[model samples]
Target chain A: MSTIVVFVEHAAGAPRRGSQEALGAASALGATVVAVLCGNGADAAAAQCGKFGAARAVVLDATAWSPDSAAIGVAALVRAEKASAFLASATSSGRDVAPRVAALLDCTLFSDCTALRKDGEKLVVTRPWLAGKLDATLRSSAPVLCATLRRNMFAVKETGGTAAVSKGPALGPGKAVLEKIEARAGGKLDVAEAPVVVSGGRGLKEAPNFALLEDLASAFGNAAVGASRAVVDAGWRPHSEQVGQTGKTVSPQLYIAVGISGAIQHLAGMKTSKVIVAINKDPEAPIFKLADYGIVGDAFEIVPALAQAVRKIKAQG
Target chain B: MKIIACIKRVPTTDLQPRVAADGKSLDAAGVQYMTSFYDEIAVEEAIKQKEKHGGEVTVLTIGSAEASKEVREALAKGADKGVILVDNAWGGRDPLATAKTLAGKITELGADLVLLGRVGTDRDNASVGPMLAALLGWACVTDVVGLELGDGKGTARREADAGTETYAFALPAVITCQKDLNEPRYAGLKGIMAAKKKPLEESPCPPATSQVEIEKLALPPARKAGRIVGEGAAAVPALIDALRNEAKIL
Candidate 1:
């Protein structure tokens, strides 16, 4: 029987949603799922992982081990347990760690996997390649398979199963240290985690003009601000704010593209958004083809009007 | 000072993609390819650093023969030389194995600084650089938007969740350029012509081993058609109602 290890990623005592998604994926494989918790709050993470259907939660309590250290430890655990597969959430931390673990274990790794299944004695994982343009099915030659599940690709359910929490031997000191974390101005929501997003492009014409996108996002109250690759390259916004094949891949509940002529690269990142709205003066813009709701008008004119309209509606409520 | 930049050639993301008949890879029949967006930034950063510090910039890529075009693109953008590691067997290898192969070649080059895009545009794994650093036993900083190098050490700013993190590391490190690191220069006609004369070497390495495999490939389920509740501000109430009740996101 193959055992699956899910690396639990957490910050400030709370586990990320992606961790639960990995747990969900691990469960579907019918493998014994174990959560590997590192850093300070291992106990809390272990408990949460248990609620999410991990059969066992292993706490590698080492103060010196940063998130990166977990990669080495995971490799050690995989060897020690003789686990057949390992799973992780495709977050920044997981992306950093899972590959190193795979390298150390001399195993294959499938990243940003959208689905998984059993193919005879081997596990087959499906993942997007070529910026969501192609889906690839991969099979591992090694008995141990590793994968990182994309966020929001799978539903995380509370299985309510009791997990056995155990403590693993400390892996010793790590090389890296977490010095400090500085919050961005106004503490905007993470683009990867936001439920809604409002993006702009070169069509916005100027930097200050992004206020229109801000207004729409403010109206949504839970939306993050994003930009097309062109806009970001033009220095209209921070690179972290860009949404596209090379930037952040977001699958929000609503993605509003203002003054944006949808480029294929731009569409690859947010095409999975649940509700797509495009506002562009060019009625023939490619964005219109993917938009569930499209408005053909000058973004400069339509944006302010839309903002005022949403403000009035919110005030009424 | 010596610098190395690893780049990749990826399809332009703007085109409609068709899956291969085997359902396990991109058809790549009619698609256009370009240097990945972040790789452009990586090459630009390398050039900028070379200009300021009087160093040499060597761009590296691991792919098939077609990858030479991307190397030529980077050479036109001011890289001093190019190295293309081509192996037919590495066509669909995972990121870890790719990193190992690249790291081996980079280790052979003995660069003082190594640079890469935060992630490939196609894979978007954002892992190879850091993983390479780990494998090479070098300090690694990823998602670097800004960088300043001096006297065998450097400081870099990287994006994180809801914030930014700045770190200082010694030379002989690997850093992945994020989108905002620097604006990449367009290849002028002169540069394009000059690139033909630049020295580019091609070498093949053993295919790195992969442990993770893809099982099946399919397009995500298509979204259902959405109905517009109304138009203008009048539509606001219905939008809110639908968000609260129908979508249940509110």
Candidate 2:
């Protein structure tokens, strides 16, 4: 079987959900899976990779978060194992380093792929082009197929197996060095990873009016607040929360667009959501055309009522 | 300081892209084209760096001769010159090949710093910048929202899903710009006239073998049409019922 190497990132001694999903994807390909990890708690995380179908795990002794250095270690591991494929999640750091690793290996990278499959001896991936407006299925002719899988798209398998764990190469000091990091306040959920997203647009009227969105998001408990390009450009919301072609493409289980008229750009971002709900004053808004359910009226009156209803349901359950 | 800004011409954001007859490419006919959104930021940042550090800013791109429009626009915004590595099939080439092509040009141009958008709005690969840095053996930081350049060194802050990460890197580095880094300035009429006379060079890109090929291209399936469950605040109950009982996702 061909060997596939997966780069795993972790938190609190466990693999991040996206990393687990990457391992799961590699294992599902019916290949020999080797996982490579770095940073503190990598050993603990490496030990748990077997459940996700990794046959072996290599922990690189890199404590610092340096993208170039990480790529070096991953490239070395790929060479050592003669891996035919490499996989990582499409997180910020993953996107940062995977391309460098591919360059080191003299290969091309497929970013934020939504699907992967084996075709005879070739690996094929499905990814969004034109900001999710077009889905392109691709095959890599490079020696190793390098790809970053989109989060929440693949399943995490439990094989009840154990991976043989070992140490890999030590990292060298890279030219770019990580200094310090400031975590987002309140440990707020990221819109891309949230189960439910409550997004607002100009209909909110002002920055402070987003309190209604926050209240609704709080009611959901796991929901994140998102914004349209207009709001983000107007400085009413952070760019991170913008959901559109130039922003994040989110596929949460539930997506709620309030006061958004559903520009084509905004629709491209959240159109893949499992269930969409749009609330706007304009009855003829384009967003309602794609929404699974819609409420027409003043967002000021509708949002508070929806929040109360959501809280009531949560309380009963 | 010598600065270079790499850009890509892409379909405008408002476009509803359609698949071509080949079933593996976009229907380019009648599609409006413009500089990728973040690339505008890249061009702006390059001019700013030149103003602060006193150097020439070269705007580089890989596209058809028609891309001169984008290059001239950058020049109008204070870029010193423009270079187009003319390639009609740039969209078909994978990130590595694109990086190698750029590395060849950047090596020839010689720069202290390079800027690119965090992600190309077209393919959304977000790879060429770091890949080019690796090919050139230089440091790279992606999704940079804030930056401060010093003599032969710099500090950058990048946005991440987890938090904001700060990095210290030396000169001769690649920094991929994120939105909010700066508000890109518009070119005035005088600058536009001046841009018409600025040096804009065009050459064929050195051929590199692409490792990826598109097997198929198609639009995602249309969402099933939905209904207005109810109207106003009174609709909340029915919406809740649908979510709890039907979607089972509440």
Candidate 3:
């Protein structure tokens, strides 16, 4: 079997959901899966990788947050294991490190791949091009197929297996070092990872009006507030919340677009969402064309009412 | 300080793409082209650094001669010069190959700092900047939103899933720009005329064999047409009912 090395990220002492999903994806292809972990608490995290489908785990002794340094460790692990493929979650840090690892191995790196499969002797990946407008299936001819897997796209399975854990390599010093981290306000969900996204546009009128969207998101309990490019460009919301071609592409279980006219750019970001709901005053809004369910009315009145209903539903539970 | 900003020419976001006859590439019909969105920020940052540190800003790209339009646009925005590593098959080159070519040019230029958009709008690989840095044996920070430089070193902040991460790196490093880093300035008529007088050099990129092969390219599946739940606030109950019962997403 071909050996597949997966770079697993962890929080505290447990593996992150996205990293487990990446491990699940690698094992599903019938490859010999090896998991690699680094940084603080990585030793404990390595022992847990087997439950997520990794057959073996290597713990790298590195405590600092330096992508280049981490890349050096991952590249060394790949060569040590003679892996045919390397995979990581397509998170901010994953994207930062995987490219350097690929470069070290003299291979091309594929970012944010949504699908992976083994075709005979080839490993094929499916990824979005041009900001989700085009889906391209690709095959690699490099020594190792390096890719970052998109979150929530793959399954996380538990096999009740135990991995043979061992110490691997130590990270080299990085020229660029992480000095500090300023965490976003605690308990707030990121739009990209949240299951539900409540996005607003110019129809909100002003910045303060976003409180209505926030209340709705709060009612959902698991939802994150997002923004259209119009609002983000106008400084009504941070660029981090913008959902469009030029912004982040979000694929949520439920995506609600309020006051958005559904520009091609905005639609491309959320159209892949499982369920789309649009609330707009304009009856002819383009967003309605893509919404699985749409409410044609003033968002000012409908959003508050929706929030109340959601709260009631949660209360009943 | 010597600064270089790398950019790519891509189709505007307004385009509704159609699959070409080859079924593996853009149709290239009526597609309008512009500098990739975040690259304007890269150019702006480069010029700002040049102004603050007294250096020459060089805009670089690897594409067909047509990419000169974007290079000249950067020059008009205060870059001292431009270089285009002419590659007719630029769009088809894999990310590592593209980074290798750019790394060669950056080394030859002996730049102190290099900036690039987090990802090219075309393939959206988001790999070239860090890959280039690795190939050149330099430090790299990706998706940078804020930055400050002094004493031959820089501090940058990037937005991550959990929070904002601050990184400190020395000179001769690579930084990939994100939006909100700065508002890119528009070129005035005088600036445009001056840009015509600026140097724009073009050279043939070394032929590189791509490691990744596109098997197929197609538009994403369209969402099924949907129904209007109801009008106004009265629609809330029905929407909730559908979410709970039909979609089971509540």
Question: What are the per-model DockQ values?
Answer: 0.44, 0.86, 0.86
Model 1 residue B215 lDDT score: 55
How close to the true structure is residue B168 of candidate 1, measured as C-alpha lDDT?
Answer: 66
Please list all clashing residue pairs in model 3, or write none if there are none: none
Per-residue lDDT for A1-317 in model 1, tens only?
47888898876665578898888888877888888888767777687787787889888887653444667787888888888888888876677678778767766567787778886757777777666655667777765787888777777868988778888877655444445568878878877677788899988999999987888888767779999988887788987888878778887878888878888778878887777877777777888888777666677766676666656766877
lDDT of 2 by residue, A45-149 (tens): 899999889999999887678999889989999988999999999988889999999999999999999999988989889999877888999988899999998
Which structure is stronger by DockQ: 1 or 2? 2
Estimate, for each residue in A1-317, the C-alpha lDDT of model 3 and write its tens digit.
49999999998888887899999999999999999998767878889999999999998887677888888889989998899999999988889999999999999998999999888978899999988989999988999999999887888989988899998767777788898988777667878878899999999999999999999999999999999999998999999899988888888889999999999999888888899999999989999999999999999999999999999989988
Superior by lDDT: candidate 1 or candidate 3: 3
- Alpha-carbon runs more than 4 Å astray in model 3: none
lDDT of 1 by residue, B51-137 (tens): 999989999988888889999989998998999888776556667778889888887888988999888877666778877877886
Error of 3 at B50 (Å): 0.6
Q: Write the per-residue lDDT of candidate 2 for residues B123-227, one digit (tens) a residue.
A: 989999999999999999999999899889999999998889999999899999999798999999999999999999999987767888889999988899888
Docking class of 3: high
Lowest lDDT 10-mer window, candidate 1 chain A?
A: A171-180
Whole-model lDDT values for every prediction: 0.78, 0.92, 0.91
